[model samples]
Target chain A: MSTSSDEPAMGAKKVEGAGEPIPPGKPMTMEQHIVDKGAMMLQRLKPMKQISQHGCSFAIYSHDMTRQIETHHYCTRINQDFLQCAVYDSDGSHGRLIGVEYIVSDKTFEALPPDEQKLWHSHAYEIKSGLWVNPRVPEVVVKPELENLAKSYGKFWCTWQLDRGDRLPIGTPALMVSPQGVNMGVPSPELVRTRDLKYNILTEAIRDSRVEIAEPEWLNPMADYWKQHGKGFKIDVEPVDMKLRAPFP
Target chain B: MSQHPEVPGDPTATTTSLLEKATASIQRFGPISHIHQHLCAFHFYSHDMTRQVEAHHFCGHLNEEVRQCLIYNSPEPDARLIGIEYIVTETLFDMLPDEEKPMWHSHDYEVKGGYLFMPGIPGPVERQDMEKVAKTYGKTIHFWQVDRGDNLPLGIPQIMFALTREGQLYDELAQDVERRYKVSFAAEKEKRKDIEGPEMGRHPLANGAGKGLQTVLKEVDVKPPSGTTPRVFV
Candidate 1:
């Protein structure tokens, strides 16, 4: 994996002449120019080889899957049948090879840009809502498209809940995506209508399986990272290398 | 009115409101299970005969009547090490006895001594730490407080086998597979009534047709608890 640490890189490349430089106002070619610009941006992108367990977001659900679990990566869903998955290796701890996630929801992939999508497996995306792949199981379901995708692109459908609360929980090299799917938007569970400790009804309506964002604020308390700039912790890792991991076939 | 809350119904909605709803509904009927904020610290008393300390943690919290003195009074020093994982330490990782110690170097799960030991790593704190308590203070020990973070699993088997050394577990399980795959797994499906999955081996004896299902064999269910997916432990 290319380990580059750059974000919001230049969108165009200037062609230099002997004396004059042509402003990259418009690209000579669309695809090639875009690719070159992307490569340059990726190269110039400052890679942060550190991962924090904070500011991460998460979601969870259960569904079918039909793909062989490759090595180099692991099926972390407590219940594999439904693809309860999580991914949070971006903090540059082990680089990208460490925290590869699978079976992300359509919602998650939709948030990605085109380049980011290519960086992730093509077949990875979300599915229907309302279903839960409980945190304590080892089950899965395989759809036809998912099976083919897993075979062709090494991507399969998975259902999972991850805790991408923003920063690492511990605020160090240990970024954990519980895959329990933290709903940052989950309304604060009001005592609502409590007849007693035993009898009550909820007043506020919510969507999706609600989970209390323990961090309520997307901050991760654990990622109080030491200035590893000159530290041996993340001495030489590139950013993109910190994003993708090697999948064992 | 909206027919339903929406596709992604709030999971937090079920947190305690449903409990309230159920409890209220239950009160209308009659008194039920004592629903108090109870701490179920299940304890495994040190067996008198074995002279070994076996710590068995269940899906509960510590009770007031727990025997904390079982750390000593053993035939073999640290011979019987029973580990209990998933000790409801989700919110109390820092509350464990010795939370201030630092780990040398750890891979996968973080090392927390005084709590249940992970498979591969050395028992946190070494003998000196335990010796201090075992040799003095009447060997009083408290339950390990652990954090059930996202990566680690809190499953039954995973928790059950928490305290075991990783190398030891790997060796034993390999041997178990060898024996099963070599012998018991070879019996005919109709005859190998004991074997469950293809990975498992067949039972030893076919016996006869008249023996019935129970007499023939049984299946082993390695299924995890409901709701969650299986954890991929390193």
Candidate 2:
């Protein structure tokens, strides 16, 4: 199997102007330096402890199918049907926290207003095609979870354009989608191969194992609107008139 | 891994438990180790003040002046992820365009009033961080409306606002949080009297002062023709 770590052919083109590292500023004072060091040691971080699952998957820009990114999800399942994930560029301490994705079951996804439904993409193809995986856990142990996720839908928002080599998170958040099929080359073979090589797993084997996980027939027609309408949502900053209210003196 | 007895009909529960143990390990969650602060607060709908929701913020500092947070309905293990809040320093907020300022709400009121707090950290230790937070401004978007009793997060995302003045927050809600967390907002507010507010004063357009704002999702070309940006409808 090819183990090339080269960038995808599409990423060669600069999408957004890559951000430069923040320039060094004035040196910190003795007090500023000591206080900064002390703060980290004194506080107890409890909320971060709630994250209970890790899965790796690939996503395409909902607005443009050609742009794709590998997502590392550290998730918290609020119930049997709902999950929220903190997505990163890699499964390492230095990986950029690029975005967040929320997953809901078929019943929940079906309940959303049609326009809202357009913002989410189904996980059926991702699961069955072996594009989504839980790393480090045995397949037997992770099977049930994958079964639940296969019937789910996700709404992902990307804050950092790491794929374009941006040094910092710039621009408005971009909505993301899961590739519904291989026909459009959304999850390009190279991308899947890169991930498979890194994890030491075989995509074809995983795909064979997930064949019994039946696809849900209740998928909302409006979901994955990018594919359906050939259009996507784009967020931007535009100028506006001012309205002011005075504050307390 | 801990063992579980086989259920009457279902058979995957044991494997599921083991899966949970594997993923929950610190080694597995190492990528998100930077999430080090937990701030509990409340948010009211930007378009409607009467619709209030408690927000528990699990945040990480991206730099000295910026922090990103995941807002959940509660701090419990099964808490619902209702929204996201991005906090920026006055410097960064000032760089935003005039039209974008209204989307952000100042933290002065929430922080100084003790309406925002750290759950398990010591008061003195947490207070130091709160001092920095007091000068920050947050732009929040809530996807789930727990107050509306929606079993799941539904409809389009809504812009959220922080309480700017006293009495704007519901009395019953504050009392309930006080009762459950065993922390008095009144006392915390009194102790935080010395934290300074922004030196340049609050942005007039912030907190949706005179008019409220709501997010309207419109379908447009993902990449608009070059040099022409889509018009934003407020």
Candidate 3:
């Protein structure tokens, strides 16, 4: 399902801007911020990095170029929501990416496959109540797409370009799951919940209005994860203005 | 190799000029009447809403609330959420000068005035507290222009916001312009001349009319007519 070949780490700070080259650095945690070299605020979250030292690896992808990665999914069940994002590396590859679950509405959840009910519970298994827990992906949904990339370029992703003056705002990002996988829009089953104390604080953190971009805190539960294994990997992120329309096709 | 030549994207050397040549034939033409579909990005502070507005009023829409929902709810089958206005950035134009008044003016009171009136200097502003100068004072209104690829303050946005998301007042005017100038012009040209070729012809009554008619036409040139105040805000 994954694309082959793991390029050296990228230098991009905000992965949104096109034409900019990536710089380099090791991923480290500093408060909520994922401090690294040359990265700027992605406007997606206050502290852009969401790396956890736990077994689950969080992957992040740049929004600028289509860095090689495994399978991609066009979420069907979800009625076209928006996704805000940042980039992360796992397995130490620049593309050892994981998407820190992006934003979507509750109405987006009601319509999904029953298998997700079980899978989502698995992802949020560690959490307590009052706060909504994350959903988990079922093995059926995750399997084939979970296959490792030919090399090890993890998932690449980012949010929709909602602010435009000339065209229909772009839709949210698609998940780069494995090749043979299906994308059920905003998998309600696969989302994870927050620790109650951290939930309110993280919520406020979102509003306090800081910005972040890199971290390997979250994992896709898919294989080929490097962060969970505690391997030290250097990554790079940069902002770019990529005209996403295609002639490249 | 590819047999077809590449289509030109920059309109100034292409679309705009073509419209100009068809002033009399088209039913419509204007900035707002244009249709586009593209993508863009924008930023909005949490302050834009309130618990009085929303319970988590001051909480963030970015990392927190929305993500929380996504993490918890986990959409399925049809996960793609449809059209919803997440964060809207209506360009807030602040304190405009007299020189810029001829074509544009959206008043903003926060920047109070006292004119020293120096040559080529801009108009003045007097404020009680510079700290009080949050960006809340400016006026956000419908802005229009013909240049598509022009550099805009916000990066290139999607097509819906730029074309279809216009406020009501600008919507009517934009439609009027398009109908009268672009569409009607083409139809008229097709009726009277070779639709296959590009040409601007003499007026019906002026057919075979002399240089005098041509001179009168020059005198009657149309200005970019401004309509009566159309309350463009919702």
Candidate 4:
């Protein structure tokens, strides 16, 4: 996680002698020139302050509940409560935009009607379970963000189900939820390995960093309810290893 | 521990360099693919059964026919991501299957009432852009009902949209938004005079003209059962 001091300033190099004006009788096509000019204009007009960007990995489920897809999210925190994430099938620049996830705070979540509430899934499980992780960020930064996210809720819809060979966002939006409880599934081994290799850190290592952060009580609804009522609802269970499956055929 | 180690240099130079680095990173990730217009508006839940919850929308136009909006609770950063609204042209909407039609709501009421706006942009340009948006339909579903104060997202997702007609939006809600954003709906209405409102029909399944089919059917000029003389209209 190289911070500002370590990274070079953006476009600091001086433009060496302005390139010769395009030759009047150049062989280049007009369309090609227009595209080249458009790209430069877009770079100049880009909005900087309006967006806060971060990169992370998400373990998402298929629509038919058959496969667990490992997706990368290049998230832009538009504001404190709102994160409009551009989801990718892989972490590379070549990764296509497969879906988008909108995350809101508890305050915004309550404003929705009951039925609307159901469509969104809680992040408590994802955060508490240590499934959702930011491989790029430092542990210190990731810790607080996870603390905030643990208390937040998200409404995720995957547009591109790559397994089905769909290119564009076609068909109804599926309400994506994180796997719940101890026996819940894990992402594929290949996906995890690819992610781990990219970050140069193990998933277990990231999970270990969250040992001190207090797990929010709201994560387990039944347990929280019973605990509030002073009722003893205890279960003695063994912890199982998180095994990743092969990618869907 | 500081994320960035202090560099051994003049304090002013260090600050400038750091700011530039942060700026550069933001520039690299900020813009979406070919995003031209950024419009800010409001979306309200369509189901009359639920109390009105006003959701602020910051939308980016991907192209002529498609726009993806980031729905928020307020204009500020800490505002929650209540949901996402996908707006498409009439051609796209017409192509959708009949079953999917109910999920989408029209933008007529939102446009005409001046509740939906493209803030920061020029008045004429905003009006022109919104006119195109007004003709388009949106399919929106909000997952977080933050106004309810629930800790977690509870039940099923609810279909939502902007208030379509007069009196659908409360004066205080409009006033609050105007005050917070330092914008005037009355002035916006005046600016939007050039853009004519689209004529909407009583579509069988569509939430056209701001009211849903159930609400319309329930108040179909028929006499109320017993002594309940439609308190909604009054």
Q: Provide the lDDT at A88 for model 1.
A: 23
lDDT of 3 by residue, A125-212 (tens): 1111111111132223222212211112222222221111101112222222211111111112222222223222332332122122
Off by over 4 Å in 4: A1-55, A73-135, A138-173, A179-184, A190-249, B1-38, B149-154, B179-187, B190-205, B208-234
Best by the TM-score measure: 2
Candidate 3, residue A24: CA error in Å? 25
Which prediction has more favorable DockQ, 3 or 4? 4
Taking the true A–B contacts (Cα pairs closer than 8 Å), what share appears in each candidate? Answer: 0.00, 0.24, 0.00, 0.01
- Chain A vs. true chain A, TM-score per model, equals 0.19, 0.82, 0.20, 0.65
- Tens digits of per-residue lDDT for model 3 on B40-155? 11111111100000000001112110101111011122112111222111121111121111111111111111100011111121121111121111111111111232111111
- Model 1 misplaced stretches (Cα beyond 4 Å): A1-73, A77-99, A113-115, A124-249, B1-234
Q: Model 1's lDDT to the true fold?
A: 0.19
The per-candidate TM-score of the B chain, in the order shown, comes to 0.17, 0.85, 0.13, 0.68
Q: Candidate 3, DockQ to 2 decimals?
A: 0.02
| C-alpha lDDT values of all predictions | 0.19, 0.70, 0.19, 0.49
**DockQ (Cα-based) per candidate?**
0.01, 0.19, 0.02, 0.04
Give the docking tier of candidate 4.
incorrect
Top model number, lDDT: 2
Choose 2 or 4, whichever is better by lDDT.
2
**CA shift at B116, candidate 3, in angstroms?**
39
